[model samples]
Structures are given as C-alpha cells and as structure tokens.
Target chain A: MKSETVSTLLVEAASLLAIGMVFVFLFLALLIAAINLIAAFCRKFPGNFPAESSSVPLTKPLATPSRKIDDTTLAVIGAAVHQYRKQHQSNVKD
Target chain B: MDKFDVLWQSTALAHFTLGQMAMMLVGLLLLYLAIVKKFEPLLLLPIGFGALLTNIPLAGFSQAGGILFYIYEVGIDTGVFPLLIFMGVGAMTDFGALIANPRMLLLGAAAQFGIFATLFGAIALNWVPGFSFSLQDASAIAIIGGADGPTAIFLASKLAPELLGAIAVAAYSYMALVPIIQPPIMKALTTPEERKIEMEQLREVSQREKIIFPIAVLLLTILFLPAATPLVGMFCLGNLMRECGVVERLNKTAQNELINIVTIFLGLAVGSKLSADKFLTVETLGILALGAIAFGIGTATGVLMAKLMSRVSSRKINPLIGAAGVSAVPMAARVVNKVGLEANPHNFLLMHAMGPNVAGVLGSAVAAGVLLALVG
Candidate 1:
C-alpha cells in the first residue's frame, strides 16, 4: 500500500514513526561506538579483567571455620565438582 | 454412465486467494527473520514454516483429522501450550525483586487496563467499512496489548479461532518490534529526572523465601481467581521444580525441549488460521490497529501507575520500568532498561522491571482466562 493510501489514523501517526526511527538509528550508532570502546579497552588491559575466573565455584570460603567435614559430605561435594567440570568441558566443546 | 464420467473428469488445480498469497509471503518474511536475522528463531522459524505449509492449496493440514488440526486439538484448542510454557517461564523466573517490592503488582494490573480498553476499541472498529469483528474477535485482538504471545494464541484458540492467525502474528511481530516501538513511548512518558532516579538496592532474598513465594502466590491466586488457577497452577508447578532444587532434569526439559517442541507445533497451527479467506479482510487491519492501541495504552498505564506509586512512597521509582509490565518478557524489560540508559547511562532498571515483567505475564493469562470464562 502507498504511504498516501494509509488510513487517516495511521497518517496521524506518521510524526511518531519519523521521530521514533531517528532515535533508534542514533541509539544503534552509539551502541556500535560503545562496543568499539569496549574492544579497545580489552586490548589496553589484556589480563586485568578476569571474566572467566569470576564464575569459578566457591568451596573454600565457609568450610574451614564452619564444621568438621565428614567423608560422605566430602565425597558428595567432590562428585558435584566433578560433574560441574564435565558440564563445563562439554559446553566448551560445543 | 461412461459418457457422463468422461465429461466431468477432475484435474487438480491449486486455488489460492490473493490474501492467502500475501499471508504466505508474510510467512516467508517470518521465515527469513527466523533463519537469517536470527530473531526469536526458535519459535518464529517453525511458525513461519508452518505458515508456508498450511497456506499451500488443498494441503488439508488444518482439515479434519490432519496433523495440524490434531496438534491444535491437543495443544492449542485445549489451551495446553500456554499453560505448559507458563510452567517453563515460572521455572525460569526469579521472584526475589517482586517479593521485595510488592508495589510492582499495581503496575502489572495497570498494564492489563490496555487489554480491556483495546477490547472496546476492537469492538468499536467493527463499525469501519469492510471490518466486521465480533465480540469474541475483538477480545482476541485486544489481548495483543497484553504482549503475551502464548496467552494471545491461547485466548484466540478458545475465544475466536477465526482471528487467531491475525492476532498471533500481530502479537509476535509487535513483540519483535518492542525495542523499536517502546523506547519512544518510555522516553515520552517520563522526564529526564524520573528516568535518571536510581532505586535503592533491593534487599537480599533468602532461599526459603524463594521456595515459599511460589506456593504462597499460587494459593492466593487460586483462592481469589480460581478461573486463573489453570495457568497459575502450571506456573507454580514449574517454579516448584526449579526452586525445590531436586528436579534439574524436569526444569531443563521444560525450558528447552518441551517449550521448543510445542512452540513449533503451535506456530504452525496458528499459521493455519491465516488462510486467505480469513485474513485478507478489513478486519485484519482493524486487528493490527487495535493491537497497536492496546500496546500504547498498556505502556502508558504502566508508566502512569508507577508515577502514582512514586507519589505515595519516599523511595523514588523510575516510571519508565512500568512499560515492562505488558508481558513481553525480557524484551519489554530490556526496552525499559535501554530507554533508561539513554536518559542516564548509569541507571539500570532490568531487575526491577522484571517484577512487573513477569507479573504482566500472569496478569494477561488471568485476563485471558476471564475472557474465556465469559466468552468461551
């Protein structure tokens, strides 16, 4: 359908359409700039940010002062860690 | 008898209406989005393919005893897909923020004002030339404002199966265009200061509370709106699986395999409804118009409700997050976050908006249930 053929209701909305699209384009351009900046910063600080290490499992924090570890509990925890490692390895493979 | 038979020999000829051709092309565009643009490919791709399949002349995929019709009977007409997907959604949702901030429920309710208002608008639009929307059809079209695709389809299948194709397509397409359609509305509704206002850090939520919250909510909704129990029940079940921490297997399946499979079948079944005879009329345009109006009203209501809450409380809330209360999931919430960042880069509204975001999903389902109860 031609733009002129659009109904009066839609024609009234044309101003909104124009204004919304302009803002969207500007937002995209700024997003691209920000991504480029991030890439540059990553290059500048090569090893400073440990993105991968932050998500590592925490086993050492509460255990040393909290309780005496039973063999069964230790085994269960060990099994959980082993499963996590396997899951992680498979994800990396994918 | 032989001479008569020779005179009336049938040759197979595919008959498709102009509207069917248009809808088929639109289906192809959806496929392009799914395959190339990679936009909601999991659901859109299957739906697009289904559209293509069912639109082919004499395919009978949607006819008596056919696969598409059978699937519709099992999943959609019975309202199974929406409830099952709700379960998956509940499993995936984190209700800590919502629990900590109960005020967001009002925003959720405010967003649904769009559904009822659009119902009236859609019914009114029938007065337009060539447009003839029944009460059921208008109600189906109006759910698009709720911005919940599954709920829209669920209600359409039950309340107005004839309009299902238009309603579902409009709902999903608008949802895909949320990032484009919503930011302007969000920006226009709130001032720079309101958008910039940073909320205090949400209080920490315990595992115990997380586990109990779903149960409490389920019980409450069941007692108050037994009509909504079906959806709320499935959702609570899904959440229970996730929070109980013992059903990782079920949780994984619900989120990944079950919802994905149902989405494909559901998409195709919905596409079947878009046959030329049903879709090409002025009613489709009215439906599209009503959908946009519904979304606008929903967004505006959410923002205005948030503004109201701000007046009553000392803790300043960014009214822009209310736009997320229309149940577009993370998409509407993400739009709120993006628009907020535009005004103030430091402001983050994603988690806070999630309270209303998920609530919008529930609210729409309840609204759908109400419509179904009254109109079914």
Candidate 2:
C-alpha cells in the first residue's frame, strides 16, 4: 500500500511537471507579446500620457530662464560673485 | 519545602527535553550565521530569534496564545506577509532593464524549469522509508528550487504548513549561497569566448512602456491563471505604483516601511514552525538537499538556454547572465557581472543581467501559481 502511494505520487508529480512548464512558458510567451505590443503602442504615441510631476526629467537643464532677470537681480548676482571670489582669494593668500 | 518544590517545577530547566535543547542549539547556529556570516541577516536574524523563543522549555511561544502564535496566525497562516513583501519588492524593482529587452523573459522562463524538475526529485524521495511526502508536501518542497524566498514561503504555507520552516530556511540559505553555488555551474557550461562576448547596449525604454508593463503582466495572469493572481497581482500593484509616477508616498511606504515590517513578522512566523516536533525530522535533510539540487539545475538550465539563444541570434549574449534567471535579484546579477569581468576586463553585464533577474521573479510566481492550481 505504501509503495503504491509513492508510485501514484511520482506519476502525479511527473504530469504536473509537464503541465506546469508548458503553462509557465505559454503565459510568459504571451506576456512577451503583450509587452512588445505595449512598447509598439507607446512608440506610436510618445508623451501622450506624461508621468506625474514627481518624476524629475533626467535630461532637464540645471537652470532655465523662466523670465528675464531684472537689472537689480543682475547687480545682486554680480555682487555675490565678486564677494565669493574676494573671500577665496583672501583664503589662498593666507 | 512545598513552596520551593512548586517554584522548581515551574522553572524551564525542570521541563526541558532533549528535543528542546537540540532545537535551541539549532536556533543559536542560525543566529551565529546571521550575525557573524551576515547571510541574509534581515530575515535570518529574526527567524533565529524566533526559533530560540519557540524552543524555550515551558514558554509555549508557538502554542495557542503566544506572541509567535498570533504573529504566525495573522501573517503567514493567512498568507498576507509574503504578499505584502512581494508588493514592496515590486515597488523597489525597476523594470526598465526588462522593458528594454523583452527577450530576456525567455531566460526567466527557462530558469523555472528548476521548480518543476525538483517536483520529481521530491516525489522520488518518497521511496526512502522515513520520507513519505504527500503530493502537496512534494509540491511545497519543489518551490524551493524557485530560489525565491517569499514565493517558497507563500506556497509552503498554503500547501504544507508543517514543512514551512525547513523549506524557508533552505530557500533563503541557497539564495544567500548563490554567489558560491552558481559560479561553478556557470563556468562549466560556457566557453571563455562566450563569457567575454559583449552585446549591444539596451535601447532606452520610455516611461509609458514601464507604466504599461506590470498591468499587462497582471492582465495575462488573471486571464489565463487566476490562481497566480495573488502573487502576481500584488507584484503588479507595487510596480504600477512605482511606474505610474503618482502616489509617491504610498509607493515609498510599500517599498520601505511596509516591506520591512512584514519581513520581520514573516521571518518570526516561519521560525515559530521550527519547534522541536516539526523540525527534528529526517524529512528536513531531504528538503535541504533537494533545495540545493533545485538551485544547481536551475542555474545549469538558465545557462544552457542562454547558450542556445546566443547561437541563434545575430547579436551575441554572454551565457553568464542566464544564471541570473534564478531570481536572487541583484546578487545573482552581480555574480554574472563579476564572472564576465574575469573573462574580459572591459565587459560589463550588470544592466543586461538585471533583465533576466527580475524576469525570474515573475517566472517563479507563475510557477508557484501552477503548483497551487494543480495540487492545492
């Protein structure tokens, strides 16, 4: 009776091995097609659906000119640059 | 004298059995491995501690009303912890590599041959007098070949709760040993020229494709094999959250906080099953041996499959990356990269390996679903 049980289990396991491998292969094969189809669709309609703003664009320029700088802003920037250079020069001399 | 006697009888020392002592020693060995060797410390540490707690004489930690009992009941018994872990894994995984190269999915599929082949090994073990595994027990045992800890635990809990501890331990241990276990097989299968082969860079995948990939996977799984939906569904949900570029907070929580919490619970629950009666069996030896074989066969098949692909395709593929198809995640991929570098200093296969690494994850989940459908 015990040997009989083991034999049946071996048979069942053998069948499962065949069925499981085939299904897994078939399922993944279908997934590969589906993925390719999705890729093709996206290629056809690029950026039709933008990712949320949370995604920072990898290639975005570090700075963009949203508006022209005013004269006062430019003067402020020029003064900050002068001050920074003066401090660095003084430290190097020291 | 009477009061002293009562105190003595209540002490753990008084109730200790040889089995409990042996089990506690096993727990300490696990702790040593986790702390000293740092083998999957995240899960092994908690599991080791849980084993100690469960084996303490008169503690009843794994009994009806204990903390370990409740944790096991809430998480592993209900099969929630592994699913939650899968979600977090999904959230953390970047499908870009896979999306860039869909053909790598075949390597992933090829690796799952380990799981099914081990089913035969497990059933054949029944010929031994001490090992009489039911079809379900064999099924649970075979998943260890998947080399995926969560998938193994999930299937083991469902099909053979009694064997969960051995199966989980074997799965994680082999996964940790992938660096050691896979290299020799990888070396034996491929030639030096093949190992040094460099393929073209993967095309940049669009965010739109990433967003659609998980949904397509889930849809196919649901349509054809609803049984696998639980594992595949949660995985897709996590991936969708990651790729959709919305629900950043939810995605972050799933990736970090939620997964960590569940891993702790899952580890402990799995450890609770390591009590004396459940663990001290001849069957555990069979399980550990079988788990190692599963990994070896899976690695061999993956490498062989890649060799076949390399032969057919105009573009060359380094057969080493095929070993990553067993889904030890970045670890398996890194091993492939390291081996490839040895053959040719200029070759870098990390990104290429990641495609099959992640594919192996889905492949194992699908395989688990098949086992469940057929045997459960």
Candidate 3:
C-alpha cells in the first residue's frame, strides 16, 4: 500500500514537471514573438511618440558669462599666472 | 511567599524549553551570517531578529494577539508582501538586454527544469520514515529550486503554509550562495574555449519598445496562464511605472522606499513561522538538502542548455551566461561575467548575461504560477 501511494505521487510529480516546463516554454515563446512584433511596430512608426530631447533640460546651464572681463581684471589674471609659473619653475629647479 | 513564587514562575527563565533555546541559537546564527558574513543582510537581518522575538519563552510573539502574529497574518497569510516585492523588482528591472536578444528567453525557461525535477525529489523522500509530503508540500518545496525568494515565499504561503519558514530560508540562503553554488556546475559543463567566446554587442533598445515590453508580457501571461496573473500583473505595473517615464516619483517610491518597507515586514513575518514547533523537524532537514540539490540541478541544466544552443547556432555563444538563467538577478549574471573574464580577460559577458538573467526572473515567476495552478 505504501509503495502504491509513493508510485502515484511520483507519477503526479512527473506529469506536473512535463506540463509546467512545456507551459513555461510556450508562454515565453509567445512572449518572444510579441516582443519582436512590438519592436517591428516601433521601427515602422518612429514619430508616433515624442522624442526624449523635447523635455526640459534636467540641469541649469552653467552660469553664462554676461559681462566681458575689464582690462584691470585681465592684467590681474595675467599677473597671477606669471607668479604661479615662476614658483613652479623654481620648485622644479630645486 | 506565594507572591514571590508566582513572580518567579512568570519569568522567561522559569519557562524556557530546550527547543526554544535551540531555535534562538539558530536565530543568532542567521544574525551572524547576515551581519558578519554579509549574506543577504537586507532580508536575513530582520528575519533573524524576528526569530529571536518569536522564540522567547512565554512572549507569545508568534501566538494570537502578538505583533508578529498580526504581521504574519496581514503580510504573509494574505500573500501581499511577496507580490509587492515582485512589483518593486519589476520597477527596478531593465529589459533592454532581454529585448535586444529575445532568444535568451529559452535559457530562462530551461532553468526552471530545476523546479520541476525537485518536485520528484521531494515526493521520493516520502519513502523514508518520518518523511511524508503531500503533493502541495512537494510543490512548495520544489519552488526553492527556482532560486527566487519572493516567488518561493509566495508559493509556500499559498500551498504549504507550514513549510513557509524553511522554504524561504532555503531559497534566500541558496540565492546568497549563488556565487559558490553555480561556478562548479558551470565550469564542469563547459569547455574553457566556450567560456572565452564573446558575442556581438546588443543594439540600443528604443524607449518606445521598452514602454510596450511590460504590457506585452502581462498580456501573454493573462491570456494563457491566468493563475500567474497576480505575480505577473503587479510586476508589469511596476515595470510600466518604470518604463513609461511619466511616473518617476511613483517608480522611485516603488523601487526604493516601498520595497524596503515591504521587505522588512516580509522578513519579520517569515521569521515568525520559525517558531520551534514549525522549524525543528526532520522535514526541515529534508527541505535544506533538497533545496541545495535543486540549485545544483538548475545551474547544470542552464549551462547544458547554453552548450546545446552554442552548438546549433552559427554565432559563437559562451555557455557561462546560461548559469545566469537561475535568476539570482545580477548576482548570477556577475558570476558568469567573472568566470568568463577569468577564462579570457578581455571577454566581458555582463550585458549578455543580463539578457538571460532577467528572463530567469520571468521564468521562475511562470514556474511559480504553474505550481500554484496545479497544486493549490
């Protein structure tokens, strides 16, 4: 009796394995076709949806230069560069 | 003197049993693995803590009217937490790789053979004395082979609520050990040359295709296998929220805050089932053993299937990515990539592996549905 019950249970489990694996394969196989169809549709009609570029920019444009540098500021900037280069040259020589 | 005696009797120390003490130690071991070893800390930590709470003598944490009891009833018994977790997983998933190469779905389906094969293993155990598993119990145990924690918990809660704790622990612990468990099977099945083969790059998938992919998956699932709709439906909703790009806030919440909250409750609820009466049994040992065998079989089948595909296809396909079909998410995929890299340093298989990795998620969910439909 015990052996009979075990055999029946094993048979049921085997059937389930067959059915489950086949159904999983079939469902996913159909999904593969659906995905391919969707891809083909999107390719045939690219303009149906708005492009991502049309959205508002996510970041603020780095603060634009509104005013030109004055002669005094440029001279100061030039002097700073000269000083830094002189110090670097001295350090390298050392 | 009577007051003193009554007070002493009420203390936990007075009521402690050997079983409770052993279960508490098991809880501490889980905590050690989660904290010290860093094995799936997100779920294991809370699960461990809940185990501690539930096993306290006379605490009644898993009994009627306790917080743990109510949480388990509301979350696990109702089967809400796992579905919610699946939704969050869907929200976080990117099907770009899957879409670029749809053939990988076969690899995903092939991996579920582990789940079904383990069903036979579970039932065969009944021949042993002290081991008698009904069809439902066997089904619940077999899903641990899917290597999906949420799906395992979902099926176990529905089919065999008594085995939920063991199933969940086995599923998650084995998932955490994917790196260790999968490599040997993968290496043994494939040639070193096959591991080194690199495939063509995946094409960029347009956002439009991404938007439709989830809907398509849901449609196919509902039309053919309605039993799987609950898991697949919530998963699609989460994926759609992610891909539609209009629901950024909802998508973010679903993947992040919502998932984290549900995970905590889900872990604790699963832990509540770890009470000594439920956990310290001969069946628990059987479950743990069968769980490992399931994982080994799943990984082996996945690699063998990949080898077969490689032999037939004109394109050179590496067999390592097949192991990713077991669906430990990016972890399985990463292991594949690592193995491939070890064989050939320049050969990167991460993106390729992701194709089948995500498919394995669907595969397991489908397998779960099948088990639910057949056994439940």
Among these predicted structures, which one has the highest TM-score?
2
Worst 10 residues of 1 chain B by lDDT: B5-14
DockQ of model 1, rounded to 2 decimals: 0.02
Tens-digit lDDT track of model 3 for B1-376: 9999999999999999999999999899999999999999999999999999999988899889899999999999999999999999999999999999998998999999999999999999999989989999999999998888999999999999999999999999999999999998899998888888999999989889998999999888888889999999999999998888777778889999999999999999998898888899999999999999999998998898889999999877898999999999989999999999999999999999999899999999999999988889
lDDT of each: 0.74, 0.91, 0.92
Query: Could you give candidate 1's per-residue lDDT for residues A1-92 as a string of tens digits?
Result: 33233344343233333432233223223323433344455446555332333234433566456468899999999999999999999999
For all predicted structures, in order, the TM-scores are 0.76, 0.94, 0.92
- The order of the candidates by DockQ, greatest first, is 2, 3, 1
Give residue B244's lDDT in candidate 1 (0 to 100). Answer: 63
State which candidate has the highest lDDT: 3
Q: Which tens-of-lDDT digit does each residue in A1-94 have in candidate 3?
A: 2878999999999999999999999988988899899989988988657446324344548996758999999999999999999999999999
Lowest lDDT block of 10, candidate 3 chain A? A50-59
RMSD each, Å: 13.9, 3.2, 3.7
Per-residue lDDT tens digits for candidate 2, residues A1-60, read 288888888888899989998888888888888888998998888875765544754455
Q: In angstroms, give how far residue B186 of model 1 lies from its true place.
A: 1.1
Candidate 1 Cα errors over 4 Å, as ranges: A1-94, B1-19
Tens digits of per-residue lDDT for model 1, B1-376: 9876654443213366666678789789989987887777766777787777777665677788678878878888888987788788788877767766766766776788788777766655644556655656766887898898878887887788888888888898788888878777777888888899888777655455556667766765565457667877888888877766656678778878887777778777777676777877777888888888889988998898888888788988889888998889889998888888888898898898997897787677667666665555
- What candidate 1 keeps of the native contacts, as a fraction, is 0.00
